[model samples]
Target: MASVKTTTLPGGIINRPGSTIDYKTGTWRVKRPVVNLDKCIGCLICWIYCPEPAIIKRDDGKIDFDYDYCKGCGICSLECPTKAIRIVEE
Candidate 1:
């Protein structure tokens, strides 16, 4: 019989918070997202769907991308209802 290892911490517990900010994950991105500001319509659908802190909402009610942390997952482009965001090869 094999002995099972036990953990003092609870399952699905987060030991570290905000750890993603410590690492820049965009270096390996094969595709990048580009935004067409004219077609954006200020919908913010991309910003809401982005998994990373790569979407920036400007004070003027517009949005921009932070490439340093954006992994180019294309989720933003897919979620944009106005087709304002497009994915291009890096």
Candidate 2:
């Protein structure tokens, strides 16, 4: 039998909030998502679908992108029912 070591606090666990913000991951993005305000229904689907959570929901119910953290994954565009979000080359 082999011995295994474990701890109450696991490694690679995010213990603090907003730690990802310190890293700007969008530097390598070749494409980015753009939101059409006129077509946007403010449904928040994009915000919920974004893997990086780069979508920002404003106080007015509208949404915006945090390009600094957005990796251009296009998950938001695929999830948007209104098709308000579009991916474009950078």
Candidate models: Cα lDDT each: 0.81, 0.84
TM-score of each model, paired residue for residue: 0.74, 0.76
Model 1 Cα shift for residue 53 (angstroms): 2.2
After TM-score superposition, what is the CA distance of residue 62 in candidate 1 from its true location, in Å? 1.4
lDDT of 1 by residue, 1-90 (tens): 022224435875647776456567777678999988888887788888888869999787878999988999999998898888999999
Candidate topping lDDT: 2
Residue-by-residue lDDT tens digits, candidate 2, 20-66: 56668887688999999888889998888888879999888888999
TM-score of model 2 (CA atoms): 0.76
Which stretches of model 2 miss by more than 4 angstroms? 1-19
Worst 10 residues of 1 by lDDT: 1-10
* lDDT of model number 2: 0.84
